[model samples]
Target chain A: MPLAATLSSVPVVIDEEKCIAHKGCTVCVDVCPLDVLAIDMLKGKAFMKYDECWYCMPCETDCPTDAVRVSIPYLLR
Target chain B: MKTVEWSVDILVVGGGTAGPMAAVKAKERNPQLKVMLLEKANVKRSGAISMGMDGLNNAVVPGFATPEQYVKEITTANDGVVNQATVYAYAQHSYRTIQELDRWGVKFEKDETGDYAMRKVHHIGTYVLPMPEGHHMKKVLYRQLKQKRVEVTNRVIATRVLLDENGAAAGVMGFDCRSGDFIVIRAKAVILCCGAAGRLGLPTSGYLFGTYENPTNAGDGYAMAYHAGAELENLECYQINPLIKDYNGPSCAYVTGPFGGYTANNKGERFIECDYWSGQMMMEFYNELQSGNGPVFLKMNHLAEETIATIENILHTNERPSRGRFHEGRGTDYREKMVEMHISEIGFCSGHSASGVWVNEKGETSVKGLYAAGDMAAVPHNYMLGAFTYGWFCGENAADYIAETYPAGAKPVIDQTQIDLERARVEAPLLRTDGLPPAQVEYKLRRLVNDYLQPPKVTRKMEIGLERIQQVRADMEHMVAGNPHELMRAMEVYHIADCAEMAARASLFRKESRWGLYHYRVDYPQRNDAEWFVHCHVRKGADGEMEHLKRAVEPYIVELDDTEKSAYDRLRVKREPAIA
Candidate 1:
């Protein structure tokens, strides 16, 4: 079987400046129920790795630096 | 991947609402015993009440309601198909559960006298107890788990329940979401608190994760119990709520109804007298939505400013807090506009309706050494408080059972074949580099659920649904995952498929339409009480194929009068025929 990647806008947005992933912050990643957020080791920042988000928002509320913003997934919005 | 094994006295699957309570209460009962609470997500933010809840949907306060009254109400709401024992048991323990949570720093709305300020939301009872500051409910539960010294494991998806030689539940098997490490926990007993099969249906938004219940609850407990030979009851009576259109979270009539808000049709007229989420209420909501007065709305724009603000404060801060955000994105304001509402996709949830693993008053399932509670357990309209009350029951009961049956040094002899099969099934997707994506497969499967299984169901469509589901089951072989997280989703696909099959089979077996919209078959439009009044049960037969049977509805301890029995039938407000 062949596979192709599709591009779509993700619901959770992380502010790189305030993400503090370089300082070993994973609060957003740890709190997401869907486990959709991941820390990009290369960029040293938290990012939405998967589009599967419930938008339940522990990621945004629990973020220490207030770096995470959970927009209603585009389809829902 | 590697395998990590542990031995414990009790293993509680799912750390959401009931699992944590079960673990804590079990440890409290037998502090010497080793009890572990396993969660697919962090316990701090897991399950339906992950973000805390606005209020208890069914709180049996002393002055407001009695256990008998509560039992009668639930029996009527469930269309008279309840095992009154389980519901009565929850009602009896309801107050104590509330008091315990209150003692543990959980707050409830109170009168000037400091009694539980119960509000009337149901048709015949006052059960709604608001939790204005209930956002910290998880933190409160987490505190209790730590204080009780219950062991907690995070990110491990429990795929199957391991059975002992005696056909008893002995342990659990699965893998961690992040590490792909196979986890095997051997225990004297297991309590399943896995929540509703929320992901069983695809939302109108076309988003796979968008569902009324927390998307994490992929009906893992239901599938595990069925595979373990435990009977599941009334699965045909599916869970379908009136949620915010597109967003797929609740329109929250329970919260708004107490403050004079209601579900209205497009003409902004109240069609149903009550906003309680019963099958009957959903049927009326569905009818109004399909009629000329189409597209129901949660009417709060007519409320006072202070009342609206108070409602907003509670709604925005608690369960699915993102609800407020969704409303804002749509430019919906409680004062300016009525929140648009639509009937949600079908799923199995005993919390709202009676559809789950069968359990007695003691929280013991047909399979010994196995207990279930919370939304997954068949306690009709159990909701949040029932989950906690039943969690306490399962925890204490399982602890007692462990003390009596399994000796201190006793170890369950689990079949190696079970573990081997589960490992192969769990790890297959991770091994493939190129194949189907779990999300796409899940979307396709759930869309089939919406098409064939969504209620106002037809016999031919459901039969076709069974065929299509079998096709999807075969396609699951080609599902490939890129990482452990994707592996978790892939594994959930199997559970969802199992639930889908159970939903279809159970729907077919019942034959008659009951539970209003939950099991409204177009072919069998009339409710046939003579043959189908019994609780319809589904399980894995000796031949390893899905089996369906009817269990007698346990004799009702609190009988309803003829008038009361037909109370829910008159929910549709008689609109005086307009002047022609």
Candidate 2:
């Protein structure tokens, strides 16, 4: 299949300054139900890689630094 | 990818509510046993109550409610088609389960005098017990699992239950959702707690992941058990909940009804006498929505400011916590505007409705060496507490089954051919680099379900739905995954299709309109008790065909009087004098 780009806004927003992925923390990525969060290796921070999210927030609540925030998806809002 | 194979004394599939309980109790029953709890997501946060529950929907506390009364209420709510033995068993043990969780640090609402703050939510009985700080529910269960030393394996999507030549459950086969490695495990006994088929119907929002159920539970247990030759009961008694419109979460009359909130219509007047969830109640809700006074709402504006604040605190903090954000985005203020309500898409769940793989009071299914409990198991109206109590029973009963017939000499036999077949089936999407996306296929499948299988069900529409489903079944071969994540969705599509066919077949077989909005067939629009009072069980026949057969509903141990039997049917409250 050819590569294609789609317009979407991810629900999970991570603060790179507070995200400890650079120090080897994957808590947000591990707890996500949809597995949509991935580490952006270049920035050494976690980011939402996919648009699919249930918004049932373990990622936000369980984060050590309170770096993660989940908003209702734009389509749903 | 290489296949990982292992053997255990017992294997518990699903680490959600009941699976962890089953695994813990199995080890507690006998210390010298190898038990495994397999989960598709992290066990710490998975299943229906992943974030946590707001309250216990049905708690039969001793002073507040009794076993007989609880049984009687469920029988009436289910329209008298209940197996009283199964329900009565849950009722009898319900308090013990509550106490056990309480001791393990799960919070429940209590009065100043230290008694349980039991409240009235159901039509006739007071069963709803508030758990305002119940957010740590999963963490408490995780503690018990670790204390019992039960083995936990996360991210393995169980695809099939392997059976021996004699047709008894021998083991299970699947693949890791993250690694794409095939997994096979042999066990003396297998317990499935894979929750409701929440993804069977497409949401109105058109979002694939926005489902009433934890979208991860795509009816995997129902499909795997059916393929293992287990009989599933009452597939037509679908779970159709009344949820917040578009947001698809509960307005939760269960929590706020005790605090003075009620379900109202466009005129801001009360309709139903009770806020309890039943097929009859859902039917009334549907009728009100369609009757020119269409589009219902949850009325809370009349309550005192303090009461409204308390209601918002719990509703926004637990269960589907993101509900608060959704309300904010819609600019819904309980102090001013009534929150809109709508009927949810259909699915199968014994926890809410009576549709699941059949199990007896002892938690044994038709097939030997197989046990099931929780939402997937067919015990009428067995909510969260019921799941815990039944999980306890299954764990203990399975321990006995394994102790009697196991590694001594009666070892479970493994069929290599079945494992190889499942490996190829799971890997098919990954192997095909170019094909239809799993998400698109699932979206199409669920949309067809909504078109034909949603309530006020029409015979012609259901028949057409089956035809579309069959065409989709053929297209399963063309599903290709972009990566391991997509592969998980690909596997889920197969399970969703299995549930859709079961729903269609069972709906067509009943031939009578029952369960109100759940199986409201337009062709046969009346309850035919003389012909359809029996439970319809569906399973795979010898020739690879879907077979439907009727079984007699067990004689009620606590019989209902005429008034009690018709309680649910009369949900619509009458206005004094005349409304015309």
RMSD of each: 1.0, 1.2
lDDT of each: 0.91, 0.91
Q: Best candidate per DockQ, number?
A: 1
> Whole-model lDDT for model 1 versus the true structure?
0.91
Task: Grade the docking of candidate 2.
Answer: medium
TM-score of chain A of 2: 0.93
> What are the chain A TM-scores of the candidates, in order?
0.96, 0.93
Candidate 1 regions with alpha-carbon error over 4 angstroms: none
lDDT of 2 by residue, B14-37 (tens): 888888888988998998889999
Candidate 2's displacement at residue B249, Å, is 0.5
For candidate 1 chain A, which ten residues in a row score worst on lDDT?
A25-34
User: What lDDT tens digits, residue by residue, belong to model 1 across residues B245-273?
Assistant: 99888878999898999999888899999
Worst 10 residues of 1 chain B by lDDT: B406-415
